[model samples]
Target: MTPADLTCTVLGAVRRAVEEGALGGAVAVPDRVKVERPRPGGSGDYATNAALRLAREARLPAREVAEVLSAELTRHPGIAGVEITGPGFLNITLAHGSRDALVRDTLTNILTSGSGYGQGRALSGQAVELRHRAEVRAAVTADAVRRLLEAQGALVRIDAYEDEAAGPVPAPTPAPGPAPTATLAYEPSPVPAGATAHELHRRFGTDATRWALLRAAAHDRPRLDDGLLVQKESNPFFLVRYAHARSRALVRAATRLGFTAGYEEDAAALGDHPALLAALGDHPAVLASAARLRAPDRVARHLETTAEAFLGFQHTVLPVGDEKPSAAHRSRLALAEAAGTVLAGGLSLLGISAPEYL
Candidate 1:
């Protein structure tokens, strides 16, 4: 199950305990339960401090409250075990096959949802007006903000001051690769360093230029150098785009081997790749925060994190040499594909390209 599902399960258990008089009805149940991946040296696939949070309201010691909730939690299916750790934290380990099942379900949802995986209506009916100076940084930042706000179902109108004397007006450079399916209204601001927009476009291309513009915080000057064009891990943009490209390459390799992605139920096959799963699960929350905070850097940073996790997991994705394709391979491929989807969606929101051949 996703962390979200586990959270609901815990909340339900708490509610049931109160109803059964196992815990006092006066206990103030929280509006939302916070479930997180356990810290280093901690037990279980997930952990929560619900017991500690509800202790005072329940009129019980934290550990005692944990024990009560743990009893109810252990009754739930797919929960292999629950341990009451230090200070009433509940560490939960899923059943033997549950991790793989959860990964499979998550990947399936990502693939089926396509670019809409993390899209939400959190800002629905909210009209956001973004006004910015016509500087390169401000224009790019505003454009990205517009996309992020729209992603969350907000109606966004971006207006820019075109005082050329204030700064160079950014020139409209065509995006790289194919035409974008959905176009946002963006008036390009002045090119950085008094260079013509065409010169910058020729130097960095659409993807790198946009990444260079949006990766840094708006208050900070972006690094607009040849370093961004490097095809190595040191470059965050390259790492993210390369990771997405690698995932696409895996799909091609798998197709030639006569198999597509299939959900697996073997826990051993899934192994210990909790980091990638966690990154995928946290994507929706990241998107929401980025939209609310008007920070495209959050999305950029998230893509980097996702890319790092995918890189660590990539070697396990497909069969190597004499190894035959197995359920594990298919499962890992699904995970990789989901990672690519998130990377592409996030890049799209930043008005950057996620090239399949990058």
Candidate 2:
């Protein structure tokens, strides 16, 4: 299920629980439920602090509150095991096949619609204005987010990025022979070999503005972003990067697989250098938190789906194959490293760990 689906289901339960008067009105606040990954093998795929949150209001011990909610939540088909832990947390595990299917569904959605997928109607009447980087990196995935949202019918407005195009530089002549194609299986028309007209226009430059126009039209408001997107709510990419960076295997494997996933230059190459300190200078924590949430899908119902993506890259579903580690590959890998660095940096802003070797 998408994040919205989970929230809706949880809210429904909370609303009903409140109506049932089992624990009074205040204890049923679904928004209070905080979800995240349980330590490996910790009892569930997704864990929530819902019980603990309602403990005081319900005038019961945290564990007792947890037990009550666990029983109530299980009535929903999607929820499998609901274990009580620590003081009074609810560690929820979705049914077995659910995760696998969720992943397949996400991949199918992403592949079929690409940037256009996941655009929703719930947000049809709403609007979000975004402040994105100018001449954005072709490798950057946030560009896809606007499309995903629009695909779902939500109105999205993107602020104009700087006009100057930071067209990717021609990598020094790449190795002659075609590098590996054994590992090719992802999205957004991978960057093609250089010397082109499309290269002249920044993808961010075009798409961001295009998205803004669509957002204004969809939401029926021009200044919606100024009012809606809000102050520093943050790019959802932060969440994606967080998960990948935190997953030791995901990070290391992504490094090897050339998933150079960063917002700037490759992570390894940019380390502790005197130059970059200025580039990253003073980015805020709120922006960092959103980035650190492990791609926002983390251990939630969406994790099974997210994990599969990493697996695909790790296993060479799109193999680097035998392309002699060409300049293209190096540049691409550096891009991936940039992603890792950005993800880790995002988490650090949120007070989370973005391990280096992992």
Candidate 3:
């Protein structure tokens, strides 16, 4: 299940607990709840602190509230188990076949929605204005932020910075209410070793130049070097494009073997490939988070991670030699295709191309 699904499930459990008086009649159920990937050293696929939030209202210990919610959430079919960690956080594990289900769902959504698969309403009904300098890096960063905000259902206006347009900032902000609007100013990161964008593009080409500018956080300087032009695994850009190309190549090979990409809810199919499955499943969340944070670098980093996972798992997607393709191969192919879709979509958001052949 996606993080959104898990969030709803957790909220539902809270509502049920409150309705049953288990959390006390006066206890309030929030309109929403958060469920996120577990932090480092934490167990389970996701974790929530809903119990801790409700503990105060429930008039119970945090751990006690966690226990109550744990019992309630355990009944959910998508959830395998819940563990109470450190005070009251609920660390949740999904059912055994959840990875397969996620793969199927991700593939189907991408096939249906294509470039819009990860579009969300997180910033719905909001208006955002972004201002940046005329430098190529600044312009590119502003453009990417515009895309991200628009994807999250915001009406975005982008403007290049102008000295004449600069004026004393307004004192009073808009009153707090529904559909709040925001204005953001972005400062571009420094160029690597004082190299100009024209120089970088001349040396590395457009895609590599964009990737070099975007792969690093805004606070971090970007590098423009021969390394970015390398066509080996050592080059992250190469790895991402190579992985997408490899995924497409796998589809052709499977087609020649008379099998097409398909999905089956077989837990064993994904048993040995948790990393790839997790990366695929996390795509929507990554996009949403990146949009919310105005961080295209996050998406860039996610592509690299997804590419590495897919590359490691690509060798097993089709028959090795004389072996015949089977249902397992089809399912694996579908998963790989989903990864490619994610990579391509992310690259598109970063204003980069994902060539069919690297």
Candidate 4:
């Protein structure tokens, strides 16, 4: 079993003992209980010093308290043994293969959660508005999102793209100006045609491990020129991975920030604020997304926006000094952390890598 599954059992017993007056006390220990991985060569799988911490409040010797606690733990299912050592510390060893169920459950939860498998709630369904700068990027991203949403049974309204079916649109402007103006604009609003998303996935996605294929390409697969895979093949996977990661991160950060921004649970709402280029901080991806949206591969181009937002938000430092990261800083830090988590998570669902550091 996972730590939570085991810890909850012991914690509940301890609470019950205190309530039933099994351990004489004018007061119960008002402290948090913790379970941690046992040290190397340790006799048990998980260890806790709760008994020692409660000894004073219980008006009993530490070892005596640990003995009583140990008895209480071994009575539970999924518990193989509980022992007292090191001045009344409690160590618990779980039953054989208990963690297998936990692992299975965890994987099931992850799959059910979609891109939000381990995501925090920084911003849930807060009407997040992603502004697309490149027509091609916007179109590709728009189409991708529509497909994803439709698959998820989410109602979505799609706008017709002017440059239908990757047809010739306006060339890139020599200089940046108001929004974007093509020298010669054309958006045919082409009817849905060509291979379906499923067919594309079969040809280019490679397999269910499509995103993992990105990693596999680096080692197990045969090497290619300059380590470059076909842009058409690699680019879509990248976009899917990137979006899922950012979205998951935002959800979690919103939760930590006392706001809810997840699709799973009700928590808080997010603001539709533009992640400004000036305040992007170290988030170069955000800048890239803004700049690269017009390329032929709209999915890849659209991905830059989500990724840049994630990178821009990695660490949100404030002007506050003399205090350890202010409350605002802590919340922002959570937001930033969630940003990365969501970015990575989104990418994973889309079969992409959410690199731990960058």
Clash pairs detected, candidate 3: none
Ranking by lDDT: 1, 3, 4, 2
The models' CA-based lDDT, in order, is 0.79, 0.40, 0.79, 0.44
TM-score for each predicted model, relative to the true structure: 0.80, 0.39, 0.87, 0.35
Error of 3 at 344 (Å): 0.4
- Model 1, 105-222: lDDT tens digits are 7778899999888888786666666676645566667778777777787766666666422223233333233333443444333334344445567898867877887787765667
Question: Candidate 4 on 1-358: residue-level lDDT in tens?
Answer: 7655666777876887787776785647444587765554456667887787888888989888788788788888778898777788788876755533443343344445544543332212212122222333233344434333322322334434444212222221122223222222222122222333344344444322233222221214312132233333234444434444444555454455455322221111112212421122212222222222211122233345545554454434232334443444443443444444434544432334464321
Instruction: Tell me the tens digit of each residue's lDDT in model 2 across 117-163.
Output: 22234334434443444432222223333333333333444443444
Q: For each predicted model, how many residue pairs clash, with residues at least 3 apart or on different chains?
A: 4, 31, 0, 42
lDDT of 4: 0.44
Residue 85 in model 4: shift from native, Å?
Answer: 3.0
Better of 1 and 3 by TM-score: 3
